[model samples]
Structures are given as structure tokens and as C-alpha cells.
Target: MIEERNPTNTWIVDDDSIYVYGLKKLISIKGINTNLSHFINGQEGINALKKANENQQLPDIILLDINMPVMDGWEFMNEFAKLKPQLGKNITVYIVTPSLDLNDIHRAKSIPEVAEYIFKPVKISQLTEIFSQTQYQTNERIRQYGT
Candidate 1:
């Protein structure tokens, strides 16, 4: 397991239990040692995000699923747009969906809030790569901007 030098909180908003289990394992192995929050659907995830924001404990990253029982990912994004400014935090959102439809991919790409669209059954290597790039970018920003 790779060790996390700079901790980050991750939120997974997916309904599939098996996928969630596998993702949790992968995240652990990839060494995201901070807290992980799970939400069954988009609505729940949104609500939790709002609550967490109120507590000043917003997650750093969110892994969102597209299809769900109530309030799909698209709907959540709509609501999130309104709530985002109020949250007072920068949260990176990744659309982690099983859907391979072109329209879905296009829609996710169109959203400025979405960092990336990832295929289902996320790979450990992908996570590592993403984290590494994110870490590098963050360091660069800090060096340039004095954060």
C-alpha cells in the first residue's frame, strides 16, 4: 500500500455495494489515509455534503455514480451548483459511472465542476496516477501562489 503523505478525504456516492466495497479496498491500498464517506444516492450525498460543509469538514474529492434510485448524478450536480458557492470549499468531483454512452460522457465533460469521467471498476493505477498529478499540481500552485 502506498502511504499518503498529504491526507485527503474522499466521498463515494454510489449505490452498488460490491463496487463500493471494491473501491474502498482500492482506495486503502492506494493510501488515501483520510476519512471516507459513503452515500447510497445523489440526494443523500448532496445532503451530506451540505451538512459537512456546515461543519467545515467538506470532503476534498467525490466519486459520483450517474444512475441511482433518487436524485441521479445529473440532478445532484444541478443542486450542487447552487450549494457549491455556499460550501466555501473546493471539492473535486469525478464521475465514476458504469455507463459508456457517448451522451453521458459528453454531458459529464461539459460540466465544469466535474474533474473527469472514469469508467466503472476503478483501477488502483488510475487512482495513483490521478493522485500523483493532483499532488504535483497542488504543489506547483502552492509554490507559485503561496498557499
Candidate 2:
């Protein structure tokens, strides 16, 4: 019997529509099973996260961009930190940006919630590794928590 895998709930919080479109296409081409939600900026992402938290339907992974209009990634991280303790499940956040600033990289590294910092124009290999890790972690969590 083949074991069925659940789709990963994923979010892309970014202002660039073109980038989002490309990323979605890449994900589809890779045959990754993901239920993706897109937010134009950090504020929208935060609001959606709040609603998701209330409904206990939080995303499993977040690909966040650094620069946005309403709220930047740093600001969003601040808000996320405050709201995290109330969340029912763990969410892995990746900093996906074009910025090559060392400060930004260091900042992301400093944050405990950030899993990794990825450069823009994300590669297929990186996506594969990330989803594979996500699946492994999800399976491990299920084995341990039965949830």
C-alpha cells in the first residue's frame, strides 16, 4: 500500500508580484504538494497569520522578503515573535530576498525563528531540500505528537 502525504501549507510574503508568480510556477514544476498563500506585504501576512492562528490553520512554512511597503520583514518578525507563543504549531520561516547585505544576513541569523536565509531567484535544489526537510520534520512530529 502506498502511504499518502499531506500537502504542506506554505506562505509567500512578498511585494514583488513577478517574483511570486515565478516562484509559484517553479513549485508547480517541481511537483511539490503545497497549499500556497501569497501576501503583498508583511502587514497582510501578519494579519493572515493572526486569523490562521485563531482558526488553528497555520502555515507550515513561510518565505519572507525583507523589503515591503506596509511592513518590512524585520517588523513582521517582531510581531511574529510576540504572537508565536500563542500558536499551536511550529512554523519554519525562511528569509528569501535579493539583498546581499551582511547586516541583513546577520539579523536573520540572530532570530531564532528564522530557519535559513536564501538568496533571491531560489534554485530548484534549494526548494527540493527545503520540502524534503519539511516532510521529514512533519513525519517526525507526527510520530512524536500524533497530531
Candidate 3:
């Protein structure tokens, strides 16, 4: 018998509506099973994180943008670091930005929570790989921990 898996919970924390729209389209085209959610700014993302934590429904992955109107990605990282201990689940964070600054890349790498730094216009292949790995990890955790 084949075992069915739940859709991966994913969040995009970006203020660029166009970018978000395109990313969502790509995910849709790829036919990835993800419970996707979007936040316009870092503050909104943080608020959603708090609520998700309370409900024990935290996202499995987050795509974060550096430049936003309220609370940049760095600020959100700070808040996330503080709240992370309370969240029972592991959430992989990827810094997705248009900025080509070396400092930004270095900063993202330095953050322990950040899994990778991806440039703008993410490809369908990348999304496929990410979701595949995330699903594998989630399945492993469930197998081992029965969570």
C-alpha cells in the first residue's frame, strides 16, 4: 500500500507582489503539494509565525526577502531567532532576494537559521528540489518520532 503524505507548509515573506505572484505561479506549474501562505512584510510574517506557533501549525519552509516596507528580513530573523525555541517544528529558511550584494549573501550565510541564499526569479527546478528534500525530511521525522 502506498503511504500518503501531507502537503508541506510553506511561507513566502516578501513585499514584492509581482515576485510573489510569479513564484506562486511557478509552484502551481510544478504541481508541488504545498500549503503555501504569503506575507507582505516581515512584521506580518512574524505575526503569522506567532499564531502558527500557538496553534502548532508552523511552516516547514520560508522564503524571505531582504528589502521590505516594514521590518526587513534581518529584523524578522532576529524575531524568529527569539521565537524559534518555542516552536516545536524545524523550519528551513531561504533568503530569496534580488540584491546582489556580497554583504547580503555573507550575512545570510552567517545566520544559523538560513538554509540558503537564492537569487531572484527562482526556477521551477529549484522549487522541485527544495520541496522534494523538505518532504523527505518531514517523512523521516514522522517515521522516527511519530509526530
Candidate 4:
């Protein structure tokens, strides 16, 4: 039997409603229990993150979209850079975009907070792997420090 993974607080920051719903469903279908939150744009996402941080309820992972109407992913990242230190917790962020532009990929890679740059229509296995890796990392940290 597969080991049940720990539930994660996951945030989806994208302008596309259909993509958001589909992604959420895929996450659930993979049996990766998640307390999910959605934001239609980067500004909204940043605001939510700030509130969550204030309550000490920041998400474990954030799926970020590059292109949006207001405050695109890059803009959000710029703001996030300023807010990150105040957050007091390490939150992993993945850049999810359909763009195959090398510049975009390079830019994302340059950012330290971006854990991975995923192409459009993220696969179930990819998400599972991410969860598994995160779980393993968490377990290791706990084992080492008893946190």
C-alpha cells in the first residue's frame, strides 16, 4: 500500500479559472491531500500571502503563473523578495507557465525562490514527486532537529 502523504497547504496563483480548477482536481486525484487556496492575480496572491503570514498560516507550496492581467509573476516575485524575510518561514514556489521562451526560463532559474519551472498542464507524477520530495525533506529535518 502507498504511504499516505501529509496534507499540505497549497496556493494556486493564476488568472485562469479553468486551469486552477483542473490543477486542483489533479492534485486531489493523486491523493495528495491539500488545503488549497486560489488567487486570480499576483496582487491578490501577495495580499493573501501577507495575511497568511500574519496569521502564521503561510502555504507550504505556491504554484505561480507568469502571465496575468495585473502584477504578473515577475512583479509578484519582486514584491515577494521584499516580504520573504518578514515571513519567517521557507515557502517553496514553482513557476507554472505554458511559455517555452528561454528568457522566461532563465529568469525563473535566476530567482532563488523558484524551486522549479513547470510547463503547462502539469502532470500528476510531477506533482507526486514534488510532494514526495517535500515530505522526505520534512522528515529528514524533523529527524535531525526534532522540529
lDDT, candidate 1, at 97: 92
Q: What would the per-residue lDDT of candidate 2 be over residues 32-77, giving only the tens digit for each residue?
A: 9888999999999999999999898899999999999989999999
42-135 per-residue lDDT for model 1 (tens digits):
9999999889988878877888999999989999889888898898667889999989999999999999999999998787888877666656
Model 1 misplacement above 4 A: 1-4, 134-147
Query: Could you give the candidate ranking by TM-score, starting with the highest?
Result: 3, 2, 4, 1
lDDT of 2: 0.93
Please list all clashing residue pairs in model 3, or write none if there are none.
Answer: none
Q: What is the lDDT ranking, best to worst?
A: 2, 3, 4, 1
In model 3, the runs with Cα more than 4 Å from the true position are none
Per-residue lDDT of candidate 3, residues 22-116 (tens digit) = 98888888788898899999999999999998898899999999999889999999999999899988999999998899999999999999999
Work out the TM-score per prediction: 0.85, 0.95, 0.96, 0.89
- C-alpha lDDT of all candidate models, in order: 0.83, 0.93, 0.92, 0.87
- In terms of lDDT, the poorest run of 10 residues in model 2 is 1-10
The global Cα lDDT (0 to 1) of model 1 is 0.83
Query: Which sections of candidate 4 miss by over 4 Å?
Result: 1-5, 140-147
lDDT assessment of candidate 3: 0.92
lDDT of candidate 4 over 44-109, digit per residue (tens): 999998998889888878899999988999999999999999995678999999999999999999
